[model samples]
Structure formats: structure tokens, C-alpha cells
Target: MAEDRRKEIVRHLSEDDLDRLLAETDDDKISKRLTFVKRLYKGATLEDAADDVGRSSGTATRWARRWNEGGLGLLTPNFGGGRPPKLDEDEQDELIERLRDGQPWKSQEVQHLLSEKFDAEYHPHYLGTFLRDLGLSYAKPRPKRPHQPENPDEILEERVDDALDEDDQPHNKRAGDDGEGWVVDEDVCTDGGTVIGFFDASQPQPYDNSRRVWYVDDPHVERPLVKTEDSAVGFYAPNGESLVTFTEDETKERICEVLELIREQNPGKRILLVLDKHGSHIYEYTRKRAHQLGIDLIFLPSGSPHLNPIEKVWDYLKWTMCPIIVENEGEFKILVKDVFERITRRISYAQSWCEKFLDLQKLS
Candidate 1:
């Protein structure tokens, strides 16, 4: 009933009063509103009334409310626009430039800078939205150590290509080719089919384990704090055949042994091993052993671990094993080997590396 009464002819003003105001009004603004009230009194809706006066329904409602509350005086004009921005447009652009000066900024620090420079203040919660509005995002920056061989991809690709290439003609066995007269097809460049292997060694300490856990009432996920580390030297292939050796320590002798082991496993295929320039693998004896075994070695550029897919394999292995419980270093080593075997069962790990750096169609 009250809504019906208010809708009839607007409130407080009667039909006669509106006619009187419309006749005597000299103000264009007040006269426009008087015409709107007359439309409502003659059966037009709030929407139709707004359309008659070239105003929105919401604006008509505000005008009607103001007219009911304090008559004409209250609806004249709202001079107070809104809370002014702490910083003007030019000042905002300057603040954005200052924020992007390559230095990470904290909320409190930004607040201080604003107060110090522009004499402006913002609450910390609102500042996040302000920074985002200014085209900035929050993130933790990681430190990246610089490395050598500026063109690492080109350098590495060239080496791997050389290793995988099969020479058109065979050359005589070199005088010092391990004193065993190198297998002509077995040399770094060979006519035999090439078997590419990405190799890396990871030392997961006894204290290494998953940092996060889903638990009820707090489960104490723990690992033994031991002084010794376990070394895992791994060779992964795209065809899903992988080899991982667990050792107390990685040494040149162990590397040569692993090479012999791989040769024994792979038989007559021309082996091309892609590995980092580690001391053990690059030692003269190790190179001689590789040549003797007819396995070609391609070294990745220094400090460029991202180029090798084997590092991801190691990370996956550690992550897979990190959740399980193990008591001592002996137990940890066993668990590590078991987890590695399971992870290597799937060949998906090497697919990305091969697609980026290898021509699998040229294996023969």
C-alpha cells in the first residue's frame, strides 16, 4: 500500500502543487524535474517518467527521494563529487615508473615511498589493488647465476650433432685409440645406428624429503640427518631404456665402469652420451675408456643445466622418493634406487629434450 501510494504522484507534492511549481519555475533544472512528476501523476511509470525528462530511472528515484525528504532544496546539486584520489594522473604515472626501477618493493616500503615523495597515503590492503591497477604484480624473484658459452644451445647442438653423425667413409684407427684399434663404426663418428643417452648425476642427502604433507593433527615427516650423501648417476633414453647406478661417491673409476656397463648392455649400437663437463666424466682416463668402448661423449656448456633433460629426471626421482619413510642412509639409498627404477619405467621424461635437440629420424 505504501509503495502504491508513493508511486501514484510522487510523495509530498500533489497534482496542484506540481502545476503551480511548473508555472512559476524559472530554473530549467527544477522545471525539468516538475515535468517528470507531472508524467508520473498521469500514469507514466518511473522508467517512462525518467525517459520524458531525459534522466535515468535511478536518477528519477533519487530526485523523488530528495523531493520527499527536503522538497526542492536538497536535490539542487551535489557539489561534493567523491573522495579525491591520493595521487593525480601525472603523479600516478610517475609512481609506476618509480616502482618499475628493477627493485622489488614491499607494501610497507611502497607506502613509505608514496608518503615520502608525493605526501600521499594508502592503506596496505588497498595498495595491492592500486599496484595491480598500475600494471604491476607481486612475485618472489629468484637469483640466477651467470654461465659461459653465451650461445649454449648452438654449442650443445653442434656437439651432439657431431657425436650422432655417421661419417660417409671410415678412417683408420688412431695410433692411441686406447691401444685396442677403435672399432671403425664405433668411433665418435660412425656408420652404425646412433643410440643417444642423456646422462646426469645427483647426490640426494639423507636429510632430503618432501617439505609439505597433508596430515591429520600434524604428522612429523622426517629424514635422517647424515654426514654422507648418496650419488646416483643416471643415463636416460627416449626409447624408454634407462640406466641408473647408485654409488656412495662418484669417481672417474665409477664413470668408466658405468661406461663399460652401458656398452655391455647396448651391444653394437653406436652410443652417443650427452653429459655435463664434470671432473669425473671429463678425466683423460674416462675419455680414453669411452673411446675404447666406442661410445661418443658430448659435453654440455658450463653452468647450463637447463639444457640437459636428465636433471629433470633426477628431480622427479627425488620428489617421488621424498614422501616415503626411511630410517638411515642405508635405507635411504635403497629407497632412492627403488624410486628411480619406477620413474624410469616411463619414457615421457626424455621426449621434450629429444624434440628440441635431436633428429630421431637420422639415427641410422
Candidate 2:
């Protein structure tokens, strides 16, 4: 640090440049730079100039160095600007047009698209600045996908209340306790009676039922798809015991059949069916038929599949069983039947799933 080597602005701005600096209304950064120079020209120290222009001493020093090296010309917006953009004006216009055509693009995805299509590569950090300059801001992610039910936390809380009241359970109960029993109405029967059951519709596809799979790190290993002539819709509990029925189409009539089957299975008492509010389940014809038989339907809260214990069963079936039973449609049906029997026989599995929701009532 030599005392005699103090840096200063060596050239004065022309009258026109001074006028433009004062009159210019855009580009705050450029305005700050001009103000720093103007303050320094008024015999202010670098520190004083920085304070007057609301910039740091380092910024003032850089502005002085640029002005000293290239006179007033260096103060222009383009002077010593970093690298030129990869996308030209025309290319940028095309990119904006493509983006406006209604598709969401993550920054990395956009980077890849530009690299592959336009042969333009950008540092990930610069991409943020580029997007901000283009007048784009980060958007909050959607809460649910299309056709998904819109429910508030209070709605789920209400369902828990209703479920607890229906079962006549006390408000306080431990979550992991074995006391969560599917008790039938005592007045209905003494030795045997109709049972509570969860029900949902599922389709077993040949491909991986989930987005993920157990595989070696190989991008080229394509996922296999079983191109069946028709799809099969299964009506049963998600993770519990139910009288499952298969149909080519999941219709109001098919759901009514399921209800009748449930009623027939438990002949002595009225069957209590816990199911989602699917259109088929709530149709006029389906409800009337259910009422005629000794079948009671309890619809779960909208958009709250988590509240349904049987959701776990569908997850187990698709991710665990569907992957292996891929020989043909016949084999798939056989696999479903085998798994269904095993699930129904092992009552503890379904009970454990049911217990979770039972304890949800006790949750604060």
C-alpha cells in the first residue's frame, strides 16, 4: 500500500455524457456508476463517493479504474460486459415463443434443451440471472395433479372425527396399540356378524406400476410393457380384507355388483362398506341398490386417500406383486386371486393398516 499510488478518475465525462447520466431513467446499476463518478468529480474521496451513491468502496474503485482506462466511453452499458450471450436476439425470441406455447421447464431441463437443440451451453448460476432478466419468477408447485380432490386440513380432521364417532371409540388412544379392532354392531350379532371393510378400484398394468424399480445403473435398459387387448379393473380393499370382484369396466353397475357380493358374503348382519367417493359409488342407481340390500356405504373424505387404510394394499399390489406377474393377462388374474386370498387370510396385515387411521383420531 504505497501512499503516493492512490487511484482516481483520470478523465472527465463530456457535457453530453454528463447530461445523459443525469437524465437517464433506466438501469439502476448504470445510474449508480455515474453518480459515483459525479460525486468523485466534486472532490469527494472514494469512501465519500460510495456513501453518496449508495455503493461500496470496491464498486467506486472499479468505476474509477474503468473510466480512467477508456474515458466516458467505458461507462456505456456494453463496455467491458462479460461474455456475449449464446442465444442471439432472434434465437432468444424463438425460445420465448416456444416457452409461451404452454409447457413448464425446470432450469436444468431448459439448459439441456438449449444445449441439444441450439448448441448453446450456459453455467447453471448464469441461468438464474437470465431467467430473472426475462421477467420470469419462481412459481410454487401445484398442491395436487389434475382431477385430484381439493381438501383442506380441516376436512381430514372432520373425517377422523366422523370415523371415531361411528366406531364409538374414546378420544384418547395410543397409535401403535392392538386395541384398534373392527368391532361390529353388538346388536347385529353375537357369534358372527357383518364386518367393516375398505374398498377401492385398481388396474394391474404390465409395466412397472411405479416410477421407480430395482435395476442396475443402465440407462439403455428399457422398461418392458405388456400390451394387453383390454384393461382389468379390480374392486377391493386397498390393504385389507374385502370380497374383491373383477370387471372390464369400472361402472356403476359393477360397483353395485360388488355391494351385492359383500351383502351375500355376510348374510347374518348388515355390511358396512368404507369406500372413496368415486362417481360410480355415489350414482343414484348404485345408492338405491345398496339401500335395498343390507349394505351401508361410508365415503371417505375427498382427496384423502391417506385416511383410507386400504391405500397401502394397492401400493403393495402394484409395486410388489404387479412387477412379477407379467407373463400374460391370465397369469396376472391368477396372481391377483392368489395374493387376494393370502391377504384376506392374514388378517393382521389389514388390521395393522386399519389401526393407523383409528389412532389418527387421537392425533393432536
Candidate 3:
């Protein structure tokens, strides 16, 4: 260890040069080596720099010597490949973008793409690692509904944008803006302004809802089972406000109760409830009540439950209560109440209904 090493405490690669190398590198080993050299340049003893990077003093000393002699080239490890990568960094990134074009590409498909496009051949086995490095993975792709709307996001965004835009203009006779199917109630404000809510219903048993849980050994529970025709009506606002009440059944009259509940929550504002085309939801009784209460019911295209964000809330509730077992209806009611309080309706829930809808809407 030579004591008279550096006159200035910080002098290596000019800070700008070191930073540019650090910024450009994706290899952790090279990053660590550069960091060790950085500490040395900043007047740290070899031992201290080694400790900082979790390397031994001997390792640090070697890195410093290598960098001083050969710069980053010697500091960086060698891949030992006889030839340069067939796909350079930019080309690799471009390939990743193409692979992510909403197709569930199998390894063979990707391999064929590589061969055809880049004139590079990769074995199916080698492709797993290659794809992972490019931030891709093998997993079951989620299925899309056959009847899912091609432009649900554009449709929703336009509806919301137009509703909001109406406030700026004089409220005229609002008609034929969204076509006939768009109008569930003919009486509400056709001009503008609406607070959106996603509405849905689910039937859960009194006994238990189950999902896979972590366990070392197989687990079992001696649980009592009871079946009841109890349904829960839920209104989930994107800003995390939600109202869920147990109902006897999702009948037309019961749907009216939910409309009134939503109106009560929104007060002076108009309510636009997005829900599936359940028979009870679109029934004349529900429509009339919604119009009377200053609410508009937007019927999702038939068989399209995916359009309503509230369904995720119900799925999450069931997932969280999966292990919980309530012996009687009383206990089950208590459980539901306690769990509901904890369900933080993240603003993300609403954003999921809007912001992310466009990107996912076009998926086939």
C-alpha cells in the first residue's frame, strides 16, 4: 500500500466521464467495480472502498490497479463470446417492443422471428434466458371477452369529455348526442356533468371463500357450511369511495334502492352508473327511478362484465376473506362489515377505469 497515492481527494475519469459510464452500464458487476474505483478516486482507502462495495481489500486493490492501467475496459468483465451479440443494444430494444405487440409468442415463434428478422438462430431452450433478459416471461395470458367493445376507452373518454364540456356551453335541449342505446333514462341532464360510479352485485355464501394460501404442509379446516340467497349490491367510485349493502336479490326495486343510495352520496351532482346489462338493471322500474333521482344508467354491452371496475372490488374482497369462516349469518355479516372498512378503494381503481382502459381496450 503506497501512502503517497493522491494529492487531490477526488480525481478520476472527471466526474462527468465516470457518471456517463455508470449511467450507460446495465451490468451489476461492472457497476460495482466502477463504484469501488469511484470511492478510491474520492480519497477512500482501498479497504474502505472494498467494504463499501462488499468486496475484499485485495479485490478493491486489483480493481484500482486495473482501472489505473487499462481504464473501464479492464475493469469490465469479459463475456468470452467469440463474436459480438447478433442483436446490438438498440436492436435488442426494438425486438423487445415488437415481441410485446400483444401476442402470446411461444419460444418457437420468437426463435423463428429472430431467424427471419435478424438472421440469428436461438435454440428454444436458450430463448427462455434471452427473453427474460429482454424483460419477457412465459405465463398464461389472460383471456379477453369475445364481446368486449373495440373502443370502450375511446367511447368512455368521449362520453366523459363531452359531459364535462357541456358545462362550458349553454344547456340546450340535449338529444341524439350518444345515440338511443346510450340513453337509459330520457329525463336526466343531456348537457353535461356526471360523477361516475361502477356498479355490480355478487352472491357469497355464509361459510367461506377460498384461494390458495402459503403453507409448508397441507392444511385443513373443520368448517360449517350454510347456503343462502344473499346478494351484495356495490357501488365503487374510482376515487376509492364505495358503498356496499347486502340485498335479498338484485331485483328491479332493489336496483332502485342502490340508485337512491348513489344519489344520496352525490347530492347536487348527476350520477352516471356503469353496470352490466342485467335484466333488473335495465328494467323500466330501475330506469325511471334513476331518472327521478338525477342518475343515469349506462348499460354495458351484453355479456361485458369486464367494463365495470366494481367487479374487481368484489373479487378482491373475496380474495382477502378467502380463509375466513363465519359460523352463522350474524358472524358473516359482521365479517363483511369489518372487511369493507379496510378495503381502500385506491384512486388507482378509478384510473384503471379511465387512464389504462385505452391501452388494454385494443387487445384481441
Best by TM-score: 1
Error at 11, model 1, angstroms: 40
lDDT of each: 0.70, 0.60, 0.65
Any idea what lDDT model 2 has?
0.60
Q: List the residue pairs that clash in candidate 1.
A: none
Clashes of 2: 3
Tens digit per residue, CA lDDT, model 3, 1-364: 6343332333437877877888998877778877877777778777777779777544554566667667777667585556777785547756776776847887778888898888888776788977765556689988877867887656656544443343433221133333233233443443334466788888755434355556677666445675556787888765324677788888898888877777666665566667787889766656656666766556666556766776666777777675676667877766765665466354345565666432332211
> What TM-score against the true fold does each predicted structure earn?
0.64, 0.45, 0.51
31-118, model 2: which lDDT tens digit per residue?
7777777766667787777778665554455567667777656654563478776875457656665665745778888888788878
RMSD of each: 15.0, 15.1, 12.9
Residue 38 in candidate 2, Cα distance off native in Å? 44
Error of 3 at 155 (Å): 0.2
Worst 10 residues of 1 by lDDT: 168-177
> What are the runs in model 1 whose C-alpha is more than 4 Å off?
1-80, 112-119, 148-151, 166-192, 205-210, 214-228, 327-331
Clashes of each: 0, 3, 1
